[model samples]
Target: MNRSQYLCLTALAAAIGFASAHAADTTVSADVTAKINTRTMQKTTQFDRFIITYRNGTTERSSATAATQNVTAAVSRAKLHASANATAGSALGVTWKRKLAIGSDLVRTSRKLDRNEALTLMQQIATDPAVAAVEPDVMLHAVKDYVAPASASPGGSAPNDTNFPLQWHMRPGNGTVEKVGRDTTSFANWGGSGASSAWPNYDGSGVTVAVIDTGVIIHGDLNEDYAGAGYDMINDSFVSGRAADGRSPGGWDLGDWTNTEPYITECLDGNASAGEASSWHGSHVFGNIAAVNNNGTGVDGIATHAKVIPIRALGHCGGYTSDIADSITWASGGHVDGIPDNPNPAQVISMSLGGDGTCLASDVSGTAIAGAMARGATVVVAAGNDSEDASSHTPASCPGVVAVASVGITGKRAFYSNYGSTVTVAAPGGGIYANDASSGTQVDAGFVWSTVSSSTTTPDQGTSVTGGMAGTSQATPHVSGIVALMIEAVNEAGHATLTPDQIRLALVNSARNFPNTPDHPIGAGIVDANAAISAAINYNSVAPSIALTSGVAAIASGKAGDAILYRIDVPTGATNLTLRTLGGTGDVSLFAKRGNPPSNDGGNADFKSVKPGNSESIVQTTVSPGSWYVLVVGVKDFANVQVLANYTAH
Candidate 1:
């Protein structure tokens, strides 16, 4: 068909989309010899005019306006052309490009419509017999079109969801939202004295978590106890400093967003002014992630005590995969060859940016991400804002990372938040599309409120300070902070050297599941600092109940392994206990050494002395019966840092 005729036919098809539901099966077949290029059409529409907005501010777009055209005659010509093509048998098959909605008429008939009425309506529409079929309009989540909540003042009488800590909604609040502000947290009321609340000690004094995003703007909130800052990986510059090796800190009055890659032309027209505006996105994200929680001046962070490693990655249009890969490796303390070691090695890496889709085996980004996991760093990635299944996003979909989905204060899924089995947890990331302006009640599904850039303290750090912000980017820091808390709790309990897996499990098991969402929507529910700390603090030793006929606790070398064997049983579900191990500098090992034991201790001889080959029982392995207590003693190993000397008796 001619171009004009084809355009007219397509328009007609669209106009009849809904009306064709009850039409007769009048099929149209055509055969013609023309080379069709599907790929060209696909490419043209791939990223055609996508809609995006500034996450921090608002923008307006006018209603669409298109010039109207009349093509009634053109449609008739296209129909004639189709018939001619069919008769010629140029193409044999009937190609049904559009699947007409055909089930609505049947559904309406089954519902309440009288048979005669349904038939009458169908006949009227199908009289010409050109209509093939019709169906109901498919509905969607209404994400893009959904109106967003209005912004509210930070100080308000009503308990606003935004005012709550980042992951507070994931866990039921200790009380109501109104009471959180009144609590004496470092973030809420820094340095104020009161009885210890849930996370009484969060001053990340010794631990460091990495914030891998746009570089941070060194604001007062983060710099209060800021131990140290690192370099910008996006452009090899020291974080908060002008240049990578420049000794001086960044200059004052710098904005948050930096322009590492300058544009050739500010605007195509000469009248436009040149400036930097996009660099602050990273600074804003970091400010929320680790802006000293409860410093008594600015907003509260999930971990007020934790320190951060700012690994700058994003800049310009978006960060490159190579740069991001390098940042991830460096932050995790992995070697990048001759480069200087990361001054602040993070135990966890928080990445708030992500691209769409699942990772292919050949995906370079996915492979590099795995490198970070191998280095013992816990990675947290954001499920994108597309609201589609996360199976289609990279980095987030990459295995060995925790995928975070957004939730609002009301505990509902944010309309735009993506979800899937890959999601390990959910947090409050505010949605901007829907809301009540007067009430400042935005959809609370995924709103995570935290600090953002207010002004730039360093000329080189870019000129941004602290301010209010929200996003999964904002919510993720909450999880990172909880990880920091878990580390702190474990360290305080004396297990300062915990494996990544142990830390991950403790955090996951202790999360608070939301009442409204019971499944994959919120991975294991929201993060709970109090529950996690409680579990870590009360860890205990257990004795296995498995029966053994006989076993010997052996010890080799001069290390403290050849000492104790005391058989003690523990009750089920019990979590606290005290046990004795061989003391003093002498090499001695304490083992509950599993196996059947002699009916009785060899009286005083077994208790005080050791036979050449007989198992020695020196230490008292004490605990309630039924729990398993095995060998635990400090032994010197030639190769390993610590080794199992031999299972001895206690």
Candidate 2:
């Protein structure tokens, strides 16, 4: 359809979405699709955008022309008509836009359709044996909790970024969210992502991070990489609210303010004044990842030495999953028809946008992530702001993505952050409330400081300042930048490039323990940038195991969820060699594998010792002589952990 309205997910309507943590993953099964349709349709009755996929090897998937023709025939069979038109042969005025990176088709219609009408139409389309899946291209917004910073804040201290003191979220904290009226220094180091500490040792040099959101506006503090692969992905003029009908070169933000004619009514609730300000969302997220340092302009980014590639995927009333998926593929050096290949392929893909929906591994966006991972790019996404379990959202729920949950300076879960087992880590997405009390008054100091333009509706790049915004949207880039640092650390150490799995494990093992345990599971813990860099360097090393000789020796001491990595070069023909965690005060598990390091996630472990306590050993399988990697993961708060490797050379 030509016109579309932005509809908040079932939870965002009331501001506090209490979706069940047990929501099942999205599937093409009739029952689940029906459930998803029913829930989605309740938000709006109008539509125009949709994403349809045909199974590979089908006639529809044969060529773009063939796919379009078959879909046209299917819609004609559905007898869909243009809005307010009674002609049956109108066939809903459907037009195929283009093919997405995951082989899905982006299609639009001539007019909006009500829920029942669209459902019936989709059912008819799905009846085609070639059709694999079809769903409304629901809007995905920036996942920030936007409560304006209370104007009563004082200024910052040294580091000369002008607003460094306001950036408490970047430094290490004393395990508390300092309330208002306290001296700035008293809470200057509140628990945060530890970017400041990490920067001293690792600067994310030679790494590139893709900010795949509202695109970017090169600001005073932000560097548009000399060879950046930034591009605008918004193909729908209606969605973009711009004059351009198709994609373009620069991924600059032409203002996504929803106050204009169509967006005022479509994205916002008709009230023009209720429309949101142009969030400069992508710029802020980018700044969080790689804004320049020592420039004395605005805020300091996490990875100061890293270059950024801005990939515009969301605009106006948010964007479609199909477009976002294509962005993931493109940013990671995967193929996307028509668009130029990325000159600076991202080492990490950071997305702070998501819509509420289950994303199965086989789904469009899920497969796109898999493709990016295969190309050695780590995907990091916001866990959403609905305060519900992150499992209910796309991208975040997708397998292998680093789903980040928001935690305020105190290191407690932000009231608006999505949590649960789906979260990969927690970071500084500013908290709006006093001490994170949802009902209490909001404070000014809680915002995660970053760079932004002065304009509320578009690009005013020259007039930039240290602006602040909150949400997992802001928290996401923290981890993305840290991943860049980790990658750089490995490179600096002259080791092989880290696989996505290795990077993930390094984050998990190096995460700082939550100061005060959260009410819900946020992640392994807040990411510790310094620790992550160290962990990554250690995990990638091929050096021999330092303490694991023929006899038992202390391996490492750590708390629950900590992973200490070690490597042993098994001489040729060594057999019956056993690696085990023999002595530890608390519970720890052993995971050993050949060549690759295994993580606690249990996906890459060739041999595992997963008994109740710390006395875990791999005795069942005879070891072959090769370079063996070993990891000791804390099952509980453990200390005095010791490792023993008993083997005989044949």
Candidate 3:
């Protein structure tokens, strides 16, 4: 059955009080409850898939065949119970699916069994002396709500990109007509502050951001910025409806739309109704982060010059957490069996996909994230769209990842966005229902526009299209793009590449304050693209040389037109303090300030030296008993200058 037919049935079911609200857990109907009570529910015994890790040196062999044989031997030794009449190979059927880089195996039984029966079988298998760890292959769905939208136009001020007008998240309200109802007062001049403003200075030229989702489709806007076709983790040939064996080389988006028949048979369990459309979710997310810039056709990406490393993990009906974990490890330059090393290791990994669960160290997804962070890849994830605390979700709840929440054009918490202390920041994810009373209908005015496809089929899909989509899925990429810009700025500044923690710090410190305080903290604030870039560019050590008594100190204000800040502690009863710019070829000015520098330099300065030439001085008979700041400005583009601070204290 098609999705439309399924939706009609679902609406009818809802009217009859049969279907409950959609959530993470499965909903059971009265009929199913009666069947279970009577022990009449069809009990089928199916082989359960398990991810098993063997003891050290037990499964890691020179060849793939050897490793498989060793794992099989270990399973055989466990002597799991099976039917007495079963054939040799079919009895206790243990088949190897794949080898993992972390010395584990994806194993499955050939027999079909019920859930309880399968659990019993797995428990017996786990007791094997050779088995180090084992877990059922749990499924994880894409964390986004995929709704096909009506037509819409791009809105922003970028001249070359025609779709810029639709990109409300990229620019401030510069009195442009396109930004009419977009919370101009609160979010005005806040858009693209750190990110878009830094474009001319640094466009993430040398950085690579990995989009780990349903894979990326190369559109006109994203073609030129492609780093390469990354690896595909969904090894199923039937999933993409293409006859390809094993996990293929290229990261391509095969449609993930579910038909009504399957939605009823599998998802709804012959009771529930409704199906979903193909999201082309990865493509939309990719466009937000690295779509080619100034391309006449579509919207401008935040990190226009950065190359995208497309890594396909989620596929039909979402994906298994095991596959998602493997993709994360592989994307961040970790080793994965059967695939070649990732040539373009990502500096920033964007995961707009997640599942409902707390992140634990024992879980594959959490372990993979830790590995990615250890390798210095900054991971940005969507704080789930459940509108509940994000701490209940995996990946977002995982420690060290930048969990992003959603806000609308009004600069308020998006009604659907998940909140909690776990969220690192919030970005424009669009809230269509803000103005409209209609709960679920599309509103063109309140959405994030990006690249998408109109086709719903596997082959001969629709041509390139752009429109609005809303979710934490949209917010995740905004932070990813900003991080790309930050990384670029840091690299250009001749500083060592920033670690994941440092990048998070820069983003948190540089975020803009929220217009209205949210009930729960979304993050430091909305991510300021311009401020984050500035933070990255201006990152310097806070340590200052201690001023000594009767000494000539030499220092160079690193760059022209830059301010060098210095601090000195004036102890009690200290006397005769003098600070001055002694010599330099170019004009240099000095100021003695008591507190933070004000908007203008006039009121805050206790003393200022604006001499006619390259020298200036400030002297005080009795020094104050507290900390004092010395500000040095390069008036005439001075590269190096000499300064002296002499004091006599008893």
- Give the candidate order by descending lDDT: 2, 3, 1
Measured on C-alpha atoms, candidate 1 has an lDDT of: 0.40
lDDT of 1 by residue, 1-650 (tens): 00000000001122132234224323322111001001111101111111111111211111111000001121232221223224342211111111101101111111222222222222332332222222111100001112112233243211223343433333443333322322232121111111124445654557778776655555655543432455555432332234452222211212333233233131111222332333344544555455554445544555566667666555433444445556677777766533576766777788877654344222334445566666767777776666666655556666556677765554445555677655666665544323202133333322333444433333343322323334455556666766677677667768645555445445544555564543235455555667666645554311112222223222223333322223443332233333332322333333332111111121112123232322324433442223122333334321121212222323
Best candidate (score: TM-score): 2
Per-model TM against the reference:
0.50, 0.78, 0.69
lDDT of 2 by residue, 58-94 (tens): 8778577877677577667656676455764445677
| Cα lDDT for residue 263, candidate 1 | 31
Q: Give the C-alpha lDDT of model 3.
A: 0.64
Q: Give the TM-score of candidate 2.
A: 0.78
lDDT against the true structure, each candidate: 0.40, 0.72, 0.64
Candidate numbers, best TM-score first, in rank order: 2, 3, 1
Candidate 1, position 528, lDDT: 62
Q: How far is candidate 2 from the true structure (C-alpha RMSD, Å)?
A: 10.0
User: Per-residue CA lDDT of candidate 3, range 421-468, in tens?
Assistant: 667778877765534122644455456778877677542467777767
- State the local distance difference test value for candidate 2: 0.72
